[model samples]
Target: MRLSQSLIPTIKEVPSEAQIASHRLMLRAGLVRQTSAGIYAWLPAGLRLLNNIADIVREEQDAAGAQEVLMPTIQPATLWQESGRYEDYGKEMLRIKDRHERDMLYGPTNEEMITDLYRQSVKSYKELPQVAYQIQWKFRDEVRPRFGVMRGREFYMKDAYSFDIDYEGAFVTYRRMMLAYMRTFQRLGVKAIPMVADTGPIGGDLSHEFIILAPTGESQVFYDAAFEDVDYGAANFDSAKPDDLGRFFGIMTDNYAATEEKHDLDVWGKIDDSRKREGRGIEIGHIFYFGTKYSKAMNFAVTGPDGQKLFPEMGSYGIGVSRMAGALIEASHDEAGIIWPDSVAPFKAAILNLKQGDPTTDALCEDLYGKLRKVALYDDRSERAGVKFADADLMGHPWQIIIGPRGAANGLVELKRRATGEREELSLDAALAKIGLNAS
Candidate 1:
């Protein structure tokens, strides 16, 4: 991606409406633009990264044995009515009337719709443990939407549902989804703690909210230091097996963690002072085991082993995909700008031609850019070195390859690591190898 040829509208002045660092940086960096209250139009650069985040979510879900099926943003109102939540969902539900005067809505969540889909197809205990997921747009119609995408009305989300034969089956499915959430967050370049949470309108007795530490977070959380060192990738638990899931779930339940909404000082006091971690965190994902809540309300049932119809136990898990763009900024940014993690960065590195049009400099940058084009954003714009440097830092590419007439003539390039303010002058091939461009 060449900066001069691309639509990344990096700007100098911050927008007046942006209330938080993430919001300000997003606007100034030209990642997104507010079209209406809490509604944004994701720009090219932002859209790419947003899709990357969704891809990671999809991979984790698939690895955890969940199958992906896209659900529509708009759904029939009857689905909500069938689950007895039509009136209970409140104004956040974007209820609308179609041209035929039928009640419809931009779905806030898909519990009822998914239940309808499930009951219409599956009819026996033989297909009892199916998990379906979707990554799509959702609308909540927040009355006071603020903080950019953080509290947006229309946003991207990944919601997954599990249908199982009974409570025990549902619990195992829930644990698998929870494990997926933990791995997803870790890969998204943030450490998140699973804290006990209120299910609210979702109506679940067992729930966990994955909260990421950020100074600007809305909710306060407390957790044991044990969460800091868990090797999620090394868990080696199979999602399909109940015993494996039960063991994993037990490990999570044994951890001391709770959000302010469900905090307990009695239990909190028991943890060693050195191991107690108290801080504010952003809710990045949530998982819940809501046994038969929707299935029973919607009168859905599958044939049991004994030939009787029984409501399947179920659960729902959610991750805020669009909000994560803002959340990632909140959790990882420094004074300069975004400092994106490699796994979700729009481009792995930015190749800055410090002296654009200089024969030697331009040639060196062009060669390097060609070699790294698949994972690099080439800054070929005719801007000052300072302007290019500032914009590169602001956009937060993991690395910046600085090329100038002096360095180009010497057959060397400056490699700058964005996360740490580390720079090294190295031979062109050495620089390429250091940035993983020519690594064997």
Candidate 2:
């Protein structure tokens, strides 16, 4: 993508309304624009970043045997009414009336709707365990929505529901989802610690909130450093195996981790002093094992093996897809701008043409750009070297391929890593190799 041809409307001055680093950086870097209070229109670059995050979530869910399904943003109020939560959900539920004067709402969550879907088609213990998921937009009428996408009124979310025949089966699904969430967060280039959490309105006795540590995060958290040692890719546990999940679950819960609301000093005091980890954290994902809360309330049931009617135990898992964009920025940014994780960066690298039209410089950049055009953002604009540099840093591509006339003429390019501010001059082939490209 050429800068001159793209629609990135970067700003030099920070908007006064943006109170957080992610909010200010998002606007200044031209990732998104506010269309209304607590609502935003994601620009091309922002959309790419969002898609990348969603893709990771989808891949992990599929690996965990969760089938993807698209649910409607607008839901019938009857679903909530049947679940006995219509009046209980409060103002956050955007209740409305359609042309026929039927009560409807913009869904904040899909528990009731998913329960209705489950009971409609799934009829016996033969299909006991079914995990369905969707990545879609959700709306909640927050009274004071702020902090950019962090607390947005309308945002993208990935919600999954698991249906099982009994408590034992549901607990297994919950552990499996926990493992999936850990893998998902690690892949998204963030370490999220799972802490015991309240179920709140979702009504679950067992719940866990996945939080990523950041100075600007809303909740103060304390945990053991043992969480930092587990490598998701190398962790030898199978999501499909019950015993493996049980072992994994034990490992996760054995560690003392909690938000301020759930913090227990007695437990915290027992941890080794060297292993203590404490910081403010942002909640990126949550999982709940509500058993028969929705199924019982909505009177959804299937025939058991003994030919008796049985309410299927269920669990809910959610990840804030759009809010992750802000969370990622909050967790990983420097004074210059956002330091995007390589996995979710809009572009792999920026091709900054220090001398845009210089014959030698342009030749080198075009050659590199042509080879990596699919993954590269070419700064083809007729802007000053300093201006190009500033914008490149602001956008926070993982790498910057700087091609000045002096370096280009000598068949060399300066490669810089965004996170470390490290730069090196190398041959064109070496530069490409360093960026994980091979000369074909």
Residue pairs with backbone overlap in model 2: none
lDDT of each: 0.89, 0.91
Residue-by-residue lDDT tens digits, candidate 2, 1-440: 88899989988898999999999999999999999988999999999999999999999999888999999999999899888899998899899999999999999999999999988999999987999999999999999999999999999999999999989889878888898899889999998899999888999799999999888899899999888867766444443555755555776788899999999999889888999999999999999999899998899989999999999999999999999999999999998999999999999999999987799999988888888878889999998988888999999999999999999989999999999999999998898888887646
lDDT of 1 by residue, 146-200 (tens): 9999999999999999999988788778877888888888899898898888888
List all candidate RMSDs to the true structure.
1.6, 1.4
Clashing pairs in 1: none
Backbone clashes, candidate 2: 0
